[model samples]
Each structure stands twice: as structure tokens, then as C-alpha cells.
Target: MPASTSIARARTDAADRLVAADEPLLGLQLRCGGDLPGVIAIPALREAVGKARMLGLKLARPIIAQDGGDSVTAWVEIDPRDDGCLIEFRHWRAKPLPAEDEGHVARRKLAAERQIAELHARLDARQNVLYAAAETAELAELAARMDAGRGRPWTDFVTIPGSAHQQPLHWRLLDGAPVAVAGSDRPWRATLVPVGLPGAEPAGFELYLGSDFPAPQQAEPSPVAEQIRARMIGREVAPVLRQPIARIIANAETIRSRLAGPLSEEYSGYAADIATAGQHLLALIDDLTDLEVVEADDFTTAPDRIDLAEVARQAAGILGVKSRERGIRIDAPKEGEALPAVAEFRRVLQVLLNLVGNALGYAPEGSQIWIRLEQDGPMARVIVADQGPGLDPAQHDKVFEKFERLGRSGDGGSGLGLYISRRLARAMGGNLTVESAPGQGARFILTVPAADPAGH
Candidate 1:
């Protein structure tokens, strides 16, 4: 090369950070007018540095590289030095590669591959499809194996929208299945079974398909609360079960208390146990349904202008009977007191009920539980203070996690109440937090946006 010929250079320490660059590299921005940092901006240069460090020898190669949209051909050399790897570049000139058309085609193919890979990754993560194997079958026969159909292509079993016709073909390439929505608005989860010898490509395939939703006409009813709620809780499952459970509890109560005809002590004790078990089962169902609702991706709260103090009092009232039974007194906000907050009325009540219920469960007998409300700038708050043994600092984070009960089992708690409550509070643009020391009583704080006078 001539003495006056130009070259670009850069250097990086063993940590792969840019430390030095020549004038040519200082002005190189890859694609724009901005200057490049004096660091190792190119992966190829970094690889060369790493290689030089590993071999402890000088290395040189001529390669085609890109600076933004411009392609540059240059000779690069990396030498291991005490400070780090020193890189030298010579004749970094823009040059178009031969067979440009072939390069474009290769790039397009890689992009398509990346798109398909991403789709497969998503489907795999969701457990949307499973792989199976069989000896010989057509698509329709495969469908029959899955109980989809007996003698037709798997495609015929699903009613794919016009834009989704290629979805099934794509699934075949990925060795998986595709989920298609049926005309009834329910989803059909489909899986493909490969028909071939072990470790061999599928000679044929079978299709397995099923509805994603539960069948309403089934002989046994779904015990899930969310599934029941989806069809209107009161109109479907709750009315049927709650009424009977209530009657059973009422009758059990009458027998246990001897309010009806006189009963033997043994039968009365049995009735008491039955009622207790019934109550526990009912509470479990409630917690499970709440769990389902809060965990749903589309779960949301209906925000409204409401009074935090009012909600706190309502929660206290609802738990009053239980509080009295335990000889625990509830101190709620004074009548007509208002703490304006922006949140959903029902959701706020739900969160407060969970918190207070927890407090009532743990608070010392005859101790007072205070439900207080206040307004801070831009925020409204409700503080539930209990005389229960406070939580350790270490347990604060763990308590809000799902299925966490701080080692307390058989307490009729599913460990999901706090988790679900916190989620609901957040959905209403608020948060539920706790403050306590091991010796100090626990204080739970619920905060939400302050309601403005304009009803915003």
C-alpha cells in the first residue's frame, strides 16, 4: 500500500469495551451522519480481539463488512498487547459485492425463517400444540384419530377464516398444531400426530382436536367459579348450589343449636362439624373463583368515583358477625365520613374484605381492628390495623405471592387471597402494601387515585 493510503482503526480492552479509534472510524456512523463512538462498534472486530487474546498471537484477514447500509472491504489485523487487543484496518472503502441478487434472496429467506421460528416459540410456550406419531394415515384419517373426523382432511374439520388458510400449512412445517376458532366463538385446539418410524420424518399425520371451553350440558357441573361466572354466576351455578348449601347450613345450625326438635348430643355434634366443613368448602370455592378472575389476561376493574371510607365501613359490617363471634371489635370510619377515591366499588370492597378477614383471623381475641381512611395528595388511602402478631420483615414480599401462607396450613386459606387482592387493587390503578415489625402489630394500607371534583 502507498504511504499516503488511508486506514481506519480501533481498540478494545479485554472486557470488549471500545477504548480507542482512528480518525476514519471516529467519523463512521454505520448509516447516518452521526459519529461512531470510540468503542468496539463491530462484532467482527470484537471476535478478532477475542481470538487474538485466546491465541496470544497477531492475526490478519481481509473481509467484507458493513458500515450502516454501505459495504466496506478492508484488511483487519489484531495484536495482543499488555493494555488489550490493538486492531488495525487498511483500505476501508465502500464496495458492492458480486452476486447482489443472490444476497437479497438469501436475506429474504433468513427473514422468513426468523418469522416462523418466532411463531413456533410462542405456540410452544403456551402448550397450544403437542406432537404425536402413527404408522400410516391421511390428514382426514389423522383427524379421526383425534376424534375430529373419520375420513376427511384435517383442514375440513376446522372452519378457518379466509386470511388463516395458510396457518395449517405453516403448523405442518413447524411440527406442531394450530388453534382455530369455531363458528360458535369457542376455540378448537388441534394437534398433529406424525405417522412414521422412530426418528424418521413423518410419512403421514393424524389430527387431534377438541373444544377449549367446557361443555355446559355435561352430567357433572364445573366447580370452577370463573367458568360459572362467564355464563352469569347467579343465573347458573351459584343459585343452584348456594341455595342448597344455605339450606343445609340452616338445617345443620337448627339441629346443632337444638332450635328445631330435640336431638341427641352425638347427632348435634355431627351437625356442627358438617356445618363447619360446609362453610370451609364454600370459602374455598370463593377464593378459587377470585383466583381465576384475577389471573385472567383480560381482567379489569370498573373504576368509579367512590368513597373509601364508605367501602371500609361496608367491609366491617359484612364481617361484623364473625368479629362478634370471635369477640373482636371492628372500629370503622364514622358515619358520613368520606375519603374520595377513584377505583371500582366492588373491587375495592373485595380487597378490603380479604384484608380484614385476614386480620380477624389473626388478631388477638377481644382486640380491636381499626378501619381508617385518609386522603394524601393525589391519593386516597385505607389503613386496616390489627392486634395480630406482625409479620417479619423477610416475609413481607413472600406474603403477597400466590400460594404463600407463611407456613400456616389447614387454616381454610388457599394462600391466594392476598395475591388476588393485590392484583385487583393494581387493576384499579392502586396498590396494597403492608407495614410491620415482628413485635409490632400489622398495618395494611390500600391506596388508590384521589377522585377529583370533576368526576375524572
Candidate 2:
């Protein structure tokens, strides 16, 4: 290729470290819009390049490059082959078609049209497994097992009303009509769309599979709208509901304890049950509201330098009464023992309280629950080990899933505690994990980013 005709190129490793660049690529100064370097050096483009390299995929985009007074429209392609990204670029001035190089202009026009069609295909692809025509009707194992069935006949896998072979398959897609596809194990709907060079015969058809689940009758709310609704409910409804609920518990407690006046034994027992039920209701309400808050897109935690040991101690103390009632002892960290971690204090305390409470619930009477703190490199760890009937190996991960209680009955828990605790830990730059085997009891580990002593 001629020097000017050749595409400007560069190479970068998986880490996004610049390994090499051609003379033309480096010589051509690019910018985002102003003085800064544009297409070649922009963070978003580099990130895309890095992703393509890591995922072993091909990525392409059309970008604008300024060449003095001229606005150059450039097509960039990053192909990951072997280990690094092969970045290539082709550009044309953004002006009327050049008469002298009509052939070159035509090719550029075709590429631009292809890009437009590809963009539409991608939008459809978001909800479907996109596939292109090959010599055989094979399916590529992509997007997980969702798109698996390679090297098979199109007619065997898909059922178009009057089509057979790949050519007619492209026709079905080119017709822009819905076509039913045979699922590997069942029947499902799919869409085939023609894709190839513009103004030429399509080389293959783009296949899109219908989702197994039926579409909602009503459109689902957007994340932002969901967040807004969650915030509104959390702000306006929780406090309003909590006030009466709190008073009911308080009044029930007074009646049960007979603090105000003497009460009959039967009445006192009824009052105690009411108080217990009210407390359970209050906890459920709090959990439901917290679930909404955590699932919201805008959920965030306020982070600061907090001692993990102190948080664990405070959480154990808060749940101590219940532990004592159950005859379960909480073994917390000794005084002045600190494990500095970077996290929000209240959130950490809430997570620890949940873990300790869970241990207290499952552990046998007279058994001990240990809350130990330690540090590993950049992470601070709080391990809560219980002497309860241990979890099955399979149940370890499942327990962390939302609303998963592993068939435990009458626990008064909404099954959101572990889920919410894990989310809170992650929001504060940490994670919560469990280690257990049947008959061995369970150990819950909470790890957070350790804080620098100097920063504290």
C-alpha cells in the first residue's frame, strides 16, 4: 500500500500499555475536540481497545479527527489477534465526494452505510443473540450457552415458512419479518436480518433469538425512575409508618412489663405476644425498605476510616441481649485491639450486627460465637464463626442469594439480611463471604479495604 493510502496503525498490550505505533499514527496529531489528543489517546477509546484485547474480540468505531482546518472522518478498527490489539484507521475528509477519486469515495460511502446498519443490528442484538451467515448453519458459542450450536444446518435449527439453506435465510431476514427458530430443546421465536456490504448482495443473515420469558404487558420502569420511586418511598413512607409502629411496640412493652399499672397474667401474656409480633413486623418493614434502597441504582455508602474491631465489638454488644437470652455467648475482640479498615462506620456496624445475629440464631444454646478481626495486605477482615448446625457445601453460596433461607422455618427473617449485608459491604469497597460444611458450623468473613495508619 502507498504511504498515504495505508491505514495509520498502533499496537497496545492487554494492560493498555502502549507497545508501539507506526510513524503515520504518531505523526498525525488527534484530539477529542480541542488541544487534547483525540481518537488515538482518548480514555474511552483506549478502554475499548483494552477490552477488545482482553476479550479477544474485534471492535470498530467511526471517529472524527481534526487535520488543521479540515475535519477528517476516520474509521478505527481494533482486532485482537494472539495477545495484543492491532489498531488500524482509515480516514476521509468530511466534504462532498471527490470527483477524481470516485472509487475511494464509493468505498467510504459503503462503509458508512454498513456502520448505520450495524448500529441498528446492535440495538436489536441487545435483546437477542446475534449471528451472521457462514458456509454452514453453525452457531457460535457466545454470550454463554445462550448461543451455542455451531456447525449445524440453518434449516435444521431454524424454521422459516418457505426457506431452506443460507440464501433463503438471508432473504427471510432481508424481508424484515419475524421468523420462528427451533430451540435446541424447545421452540422459540427468532429474527433474521440481512447484513453485508451496502448496495450489494448480503453475504449472510444476522440471527436474533427471542427471550424465553414473555415480554411484560407494561413497559418496565427505567433505573432512574425506579431509584426516584425508591427514594420517595424511603423518605415519605418509612418514617410515617415507623412512628405508629414504634409507638405500638412501646405501648405493648409497657403493658407486658406492667410498668404503668398492675395487669392480669393472661393480659400480660397477650401483651408480650403483641410486643414480639410488633417487633418482628418492625424488622420486616425495615428490611423491605432497606431492600428497596440497596437495589436502587443510586444506593451509596459514606466511607471513612473506621476500625473493624471496634465495629465488630459494637455490633456484638448491640445484639448481646438476644444472645444472652438464647444462652449463646458472643466472644468479641478485646479492648484496644484495632483492625483499621476503610469503610462507613454505620454500614459496617449494621453488617456485623446482621452476621452476629445470624450466628446467635443458628448456634446451639451454650455455644459460643466468635467475632475475630485481622488484616491481610490491603484488606481488613472480620470473621464471625458460629457453633450452629453447619451449612451444606452447596448452601454456602446459595445462602447469600436474596430471599434464600435454605428452608429454615419460623426464623422471623425476611431472608434479606445476608443479601443486604453483602451489598453494604460491597458498597463500602469490600465483600462478605461464608465458609462452611455440613456439621462443621458456619464462618462468615467480611473483608474491607484496609486504611493506612497515616491517613487515620
TM-score winner among the candidates?
Answer: 2
Report the lDDT of model 1 for residue 389: 89
lDDT of 2 by residue, 1-456 (tens): 122445777776656655666644454433223122223454344666877877778998865433333334557799987756788877633433212244433333332222212111211112232223211011211222232333343334445555554533334443434345332232334444443323645333444443233222223444433433345345446544544655566566665554544333445567768766766776887787778878888889867777777677656655655676688888888767988888876578778889998898889999999999888899999999999888887888899999888888775788999999999989888899999988788999999999998884
Query: What C-alpha lDDT does candidate 1 achieve relative to the native structure?
Result: 0.61
Model 1, span 1-456: residue lDDT tens: 112246677776767556777765555433223323444545455566778888899999865544433455568888888778877888667643232345333333322222112111111111222222111111222322323222233454445543455334644443334455332344544444343333644434434443324323334433332233453333355334533554455556655554454333445578778766766666665676677667778888767677787677667765765787799999988767888888876688789989999999889899999998878889899999998889999988889999898888777788989998899888888899999888678999999999996775
Candidate 2, clashing residue pairs?
30-38, 31-37, 31-38, 32-38, 137-152, 138-151, 139-150, 173-192
Model 2, runs deviating above 4 Å? 1-235
lDDT of 1 at 429: 87
The numbered model that scores best in lDDT is 1
lDDT of model 1 at position 229: 40
